[model samples]
Target: MQQGAEYSLDDHGADGTRLVLSGHLTLASIGPFDRAVKAIDGPIHAIDLAGVEEIDTVGAWVVCRAAHRLSSEITGASPEALRLLASVQDIDVDGPMRPPRPPVWERVPLAVGDKVFGARSGIYGVVAFFGQILIGAGSLIRHPRRFPIKALVHQMELVGVTALPIIGLMSFLIGIVIAQQGSVQLEQFGAESLTVNLVGRITLRELGVLMTAIMVAGRSGSAFAAQLGTMRLTEEIDAMRTIGISPVEVLVIPRIVAATFMMVLLGFYASLMAIIGGAVVGDLTLGIPFWTFLARIQEVVPEHDLWVGLIKAPVFGLIVALAGCYHGLQVRGNSEEVGRRTTMAVVSAIFAVIVLDAFFAVFFTEIGWG
Candidate 1:
């Protein structure tokens, strides 16, 4: 049987007030005593626990809190009670629950610094990833038997063959738009005949490969990221490593090889389709025969224009594939990360392709390939 806790207050005039506690000072008996102590007001000089039969952590916490609130000393406690009080006091944290927000000016600089640091780290990570890719390529070259031929073939079909219809349709529509617009503008100058020159030069030298790259980035690059990200989330990537497999070789290298090999064909095919589309539009609206427009393209378009597109194709493909695989490998945490990385892969690949195209344009113009 346990006695309920009880407390009484005494005042000693100039010496301040004292709280005297008695009975079992424990969880089972402390409730009313706690409420009673809280109701008492005025300065308290000491809490006398001499009559307390036994005390537990809850009772010690209640006593310590009252002592702290009143700025009073604790006296006449047994060694066990004192020890419990000390432990509770030690664990009690005193501070605001939340931090203050920084000023806008401080926040702005911190945000900028974080972005700069993140960009630097991202660049370093890309360089390191590129190095790993090179190493993997070298190892594969030395051991041809370890090459992932089936995966490369499958990726080639996915990245190239299945994409042909959409690429062709897009190119055809673009060609019709360019030819119609160019003819309208050229008509003002009485050079409607020059629509062939405009369409051929622009399509072969720039739009054909550039448009194809963007399409591939959106299609195949996103697919790569999503596939690899899912694999990562499911721990399939870990399982592969556990079983002595190289994910880079089995997964990434095949995608890179497929995209690189297929881009040349896809770019050329897209350019031809665009030219055919222009010829069709010319026949219908510009009074030029279909065959005549086609023949005129060969005569007006320079050989270097075709070479420029072909040269850019493989490089663009490599960039797209690398972006996809890198982002995919970076995926962590959850399914949401898979979608995020996939989006990043497409955006990064497209951005890189456009930037590189600008650089290539400058280089070609400087070297007389323009």
Candidate 2:
């Protein structure tokens, strides 16, 4: 009538110990049983699975290991006892070990709330992040000339040069839309001539550079995090450290430089393309012509606007690289960690870019640059 079963630990021979387990050897049983077996000494260990009514692979591994271990020390028990321990399958076992069990959620943190990020935690995490960067920095300092010029060139070209077409295309389309929208409203008021004003202000004040930076952040930031996270998970970071290479100078610095340069270039391309798009729409809707639209844009948007866009580009670049690398360092395990980091990289990069843009917007506006 009783549902619960008991397991016993006994000493059989003078130099041997025995564990008589009774109950379902489920996940719960594995821990205590494993611990008990571990506490034994001197190589004389015998485990009696006869009392274990039910057994799982994990439980079987414990018994089999103990039997194998005792066989090695106590002589003749090796082959036979080891075989029997190995053979303690559900069908062959004499008694079933039955233990009450619950789900593992109690022992594990299931959600974001489980992720602690308090003052100490933040300080520790920041410390760890900087520590990794320091290792990277140290590697750079030690090697001095081991720079992977080829890799750096490739990353810059891919993240920067190749991004030009898309950035230009997207910015152009956006400008066209803006120009069309403004032309529609302005024409009703016989203010169609102001299409250039609309386009120039929008591009210089916000759209052109911000949009380009956002695109680059989403593209390059995710790439960096995914790449580094994969490397971190695979112990490549460890290997680099063991080899005495600084990850900061070798990995982070190059990425930062490449992205910074790339973003600046992309920002320029996006601005130029947007201006062209605006001119196209202006010529058609306002009957103003491309050259006129361009001249008007030049007249209205000062050299300072271009400088604003250019300056914002590198800051956004820094945000993207820092976010990506930070998230990459957050990675702990396998492919899942890489994906999590990549998502974090993108989300954080965009958020940071927007924050930096807001700061720039206010600062420039205050200084009469807007």
Candidate 3:
């Protein structure tokens, strides 16, 4: 009674079907094994592998897959065969499903912590940039010939000269609005003539420099970030360093100096334009002559107001340039990072300008500038 490479299904007297597996129960016997499994008319009741001469993982897989299809008692399998079968069974079994996700309320603290740490890192980066710039300035002072005169001139033209028309238009409209609104408010108190004082004081002391700084931050600051960020992505900055060039000196100092100087000129120009616009509005709406409006401004607005605004312009410019350059240097990876850094540069510059303006306001007030 020789057992070949096959499986036999036999029925006992009213007993359930028995699967008797035989010789070389490996890949070579796959066809017979599959056919024998399929030949069972009903579900398997018992498995007898005592007759199987040899077995492998493939044969074990066939047996495991067949066993899962029916609730049957397996018998006479050797320890090695059983171990292989168990592994195959484990491979075929699905993993337990994952538990439900946590609620968003549980994630709030994590989000807040992330933002706080990010902001702290940003502050540290800005401080480090300031220190680097100072060191670069010292080096340039020692070697005046290394100063980037051409880059400074180019940045001045880009940041100041090219920005004139828009700055003029915006300042002019703001002055007109201030005059018109002041005239309306003061009319009830028979102080309509004071509209000149209102426009002159606000424009010279705050709005002129403040508005120009914001515009420059949005325009040139973002441009600096995007430009440097692109250079960084292309490894141009690395190339510069490889050739013994200092990026802080070549890329940063020129921009900061240019913006600071240009801002002074632009702020002065913006203030003058705004005052002229106020004069125009007074002449048309309040029936006051342009000469009278100008005279009233000169008489009522303290020279200290003009001095205060002029003093703030350079500081605001420095902040804008530093913020832009710092974020630009921080750029990593790809074009998307360039866009993100540009946005961050503009926002950080504008916010710093506003905060500095507030500090100046307090200091001036405390010092009896009014």
Candidate 4:
């Protein structure tokens, strides 16, 4: 068994009190001594540790804490005890254990300022990166031999062809829902036939391209971020740089080009599938023939609607690709950073697509395309 610590207070007339501590001053024996020291109410001029048989960091901490509290100096300490007490004293910070909580009024403005600064930085980074891409494009233009035709083609297959099935299925289901919902609402006015116009105009003008952009952001955008982030983590990007390769030209440019070019086709294909889906619903429930519904769509959906979707497709694709590549290039430190950047890429791309889609809607409406 360990010997418990003991202490005694020795008072001298007009000379102040001396606290004398004895026995094993260790974690297992310091408890009663700690309590006794805290209960001391008289002024202490010194603490004498000559009687301490053994000491550890925990006992040193208790001794230092009491010395600080009583404004007393420690005395008669052996070399080891003195060193331990000095080490503990050095780390004893004179402050609150936790920081004081700020007032709400102060905290709110500080948070807002941080977010604004972060957003400004992000915008600057994106613009600078875009400029780099333009420079790369110019380099390619100057030397057509450096064009990454094979890379572009491979990215096209990855970004466009592989995504067709899921995009098609999603668009088809969306079309069915739109048609079904439109029929229910139009039936109230005995104008169920107008469901054709609703499905045709909405799908071709807005839903087709918008939904496709969101899906592509979630799928291909995340993939781009993850791929680039992994390359950064593995030092492959650094190795390429060391060997005289431009990562932007070899990796980023091809992805951006592939997404931008393929979006036009994907958007168009998605619109077609949605129209087919609407036609299926029309045939199954509204007594309209499938082929007849398809034919009617061409007549009822104005040429401007198709033009609207096509115009937005490439822009949305570019935004998604840029967000992904920007976040990917930002990945650093560890594998967790890759996942974080990938999620940010997808979220930012989708948000940008939607915001731009709203802007397009307003612009197109003002230009008589509404």
Query: Model 1 shows how many backbone clashes?
Result: 0
**Better model by lDDT: candidate 2 vs candidate 4:** 4
Q: 1-370 in candidate 3: lDDT tens per residue? A: 4334677777882568887887877876676667777556677787788988888898887787677666666778999899988878776433446767668897888889999999999889878988999999999999999999999999999999999999999999998989988899999999988888899999999999999999999999999999899999999999999999999999999999999999999998899889999999999999999998898888999989989999999999999998899899999998999999999999989999999999999999999996
Q: What is the TM-score ranking, best to worst?
A: 4, 1, 3, 2
User: Which portions of model 3 show Cα errors greater than 4 Å?
Assistant: 1-101
The alpha-carbon deviation from the true structure for residue 47 of candidate 4, after best TM-score superposition, in angstroms, is 13
Error of 4 at 222 (Å): 1.3
Error of 1 at 339 (Å): 1.0
Candidate 4 lDDT at 278 equals: 95
Which candidate comes out best when scored by TM-score?
A: 4
Look at candidate 4 and give me any clashing residue pairs. Answer: none
Ranking by lDDT: 1, 4, 3, 2
Kindly list the per-residue Cα lDDT of model 4 for residues 296-363, writing each as its tens digit.
98889899999999999999999999999999998999999999999999999999999999999999
Cα RMSD of all models vs. native, in order, equals 8.1, 12.4, 10.3, 4.9
Model 4 accuracy (lDDT, Cα): 0.93
